[model samples]
Target: MIRLFDSAHGQVRELTLRDPGQVSMYVCGPTVYDLPHLGHGRFTLVWDVARRWFTFQGLLVHYVSNITDIDDNIITRASREGTSEELVAKTYEKSWWDAMDALGVAYPDDVPHATQYVAQMVELITQLLEGDVGYKTSDGIYFDVSRVPDYGLLAGQPLDSLRAGARVETNDEKRSPLDFVLWKNAKPGEPSWPAPFGEGRPGWHTECVVMSLELLGEGFDLHCGGFDLRFPHHENERAQAVAAGVRFAQHWDHNGWVMVGDEKMSKSLGNFTSLTDLLDKNDARAYRLLVLRSHYRSPIEVTPATIGDAERALARLDGLARRFGLVALAGHHLEVKDDFSWSGAALELYEHVAAALNEDLDTPKALAQLFEALSSANALADGGHEEEARELAVALNALFGALGLSLVSASAVVDEISQALVNERDGARTAQNWTEADRLRGELVDLGWTVEDSPSGTLIRRP
Candidate 1:
């Protein structure tokens, strides 16, 4: 069994599945209006690791992550660029998937787009209205927080306190400051969907509740997102389910933000680095390794220094793979079942890693153990205990693979053109032509080789 810190309860609890041997989880995904930021990459990698770990432990995992294809941001971007909202959503959504692929995050079992679920969202809103927990205002339908007794449960605040601290809204039509819109009235020249409430689109909070319930059903195993979503977004989603007298998520989990200096990396902060930009500059696996090095619920900094550290750590893992001739185990599932075999040092290391992962997915602790084992395995091989070292190396490779970090073997055979470029770069450095050396390095990078400088010469390899 796995344990996670349930945000609603503010404590770590065992993950009690709705069905035996099966896990169903919903992670709130990106709203594609622009390029995804580092924060987006962090949350996605965190949940993807959790999902992979669940599967690696022999649980049948069904993962659902939703995309907000229709949002105020998408509409604004469309209007600013004089394009259709559909075109803007499609363009950025493609970019979102491209980044996900680069990060090695697995595609969800189901990706419910908000536009595709508008009809279902409307139906949910109608149910809330009939239940008298929702009210129609001048702008749109608002969910009256007053009606839901535990409206702020996920926020870890009482309703009165939440209202007291909430920012004053311009919409005086709403009965309470904490009230959230279920449907938004369409503005002129904005995208609209025909609904019973009016010709308007569904609100941001409404989409997740409706989609998660429809796809994963009531009381799914877990609902996850970034810590920022735990407040108003997740709170409102839970409120709607409570208002409608339906069970929502069984457990709530959230990962922490990516910090740039003291501020959270977000578009509004004007401090966000594009995720694609980082992927282009560094090895794609470096970001995933960075995420693993830190506890998921703790804020992480993504500076060049930290990224470079992760890259070097990955190189160390690759060195072990090269020495042992270990095959990459990524994209393959390893199940610890009844007939599974383990022995000696491999079994001992596996148990230690498993215990760490089962405890609230303590990846940092688990990784520490793995790296320590990596060192021991290298020492054993050096001491002529070849078979013992090989077994432990195989286990290490699979363990890291289970966490979605695939170790690379020795460098691939460099093409003649790339080899020539590397030689040119080496010659440039020898001749003290700094500008030419830099240009050659850039060319090699553009040719999809990770360029490094060794004592002998330029070392080029596929990342």
Candidate 2:
């Protein structure tokens, strides 16, 4: 079993699935107003790894990540650009998917768009109103935080304490400072759906509550997102479910943010580098490796030096594939333990990986074991222990693939132009022309391919 730091309980606990053999999850996804940043990349990668690991552990996983295509941000961006909100949402949503694909993040089983679930959200708000827990304000329908017991449980603060720290809003009709909007009454020229509460759109916090319960039903196994959402966002989501007498998520998980220098990397901070820009500058896998080097809950710094270090580490993994002619087992579902027959020494190393992952998904510890095994396999092969080295190499690549890190050979994806340059560089090296060889290698690099000189010859792949 995997133990995770559940935010609601504020401690490490075993993840008990609602069903015996299946795991259901809902992660708060991007709002699709602008290009995704490093912060967004971190959250998506964190949950994607969790989902991959759960499936690797022989569990049936159904993951649902929502899309807020109709948020205030989207509307603002649309109005500023003098276009329809739908156009803004559609354009940026495509950008979101492109970035995720580049980062190797898998698409969710169900990506419930906010616009697709307004009717259900209205029904949820109606239940709250009839239950006397929601009240109509001058501008919208509000959820009276007073009606929900322990409303600040996720925030770890008392109701009064939270109210004291709350930022003053313009809506004086709200019962208390802690009260949140359930539905926003429509404004002139804004998108609106007809509801019992009048023509309006649902509030930001209400979308996830309605979508998760509708798709995963009450008491889904896990609810996850970035730590920033732990506050009023997630806390408000839980309150709605409790007010409606529905058992909410059984476990809560949140990953820490990606940092730039000492401050958190965020759009509001004006420090967010576009994820697309980063992907264009380096191998997309480097970002994923950088994220895995730290614990999921610890703040990670993303900088040129860190990315460079991860790229070098990836070189070692790729070198293993090139040396032994190992094939990347990407997208193949194998009976993890049963698919491969391992030697005694290799089996022990494999157990270290499983144990580290089981103890709270300690990926850094697991990766350390992997690199150590790689070093040992290289030493054994050099010492004429070929059989043992082959077993370890095979196991290492399989585990890497299972963890969503593909160790593809450079020969697999290098274009003809890049491959021709690699061949030319090799010919120069064979003729003992060091200057020409180095120049050709630089040319290949400028064309966005990583060049490697090996015993078999030079190989090239996208960086």
In model 2, pairs of residues that clash are none
Question: How displaced is residue 95 in candidate 1, in Å?
Answer: 0.6
lDDT of 1 by residue, 120-169 (tens): 99999999999878899888999999998877899998999888888866
Cα lDDT, all candidates: 0.90, 0.87
In model 1, where is the ten-residue run with the lowest total lDDT? 331-340
- Give candidate 1 regions above 4 Å deviation: 262-272, 331-341, 415-463
In Å, residue 139's CA in model 2 sits off its true spot by 0.3
lDDT for 144 (candidate 2):
94
lDDT of each residue in 200-273, candidate 2, tens digit only: 99999999999999999999999999999999899999999999999999999899988787766565654538
- Shift in Å, residue 380, candidate 2: 1.7
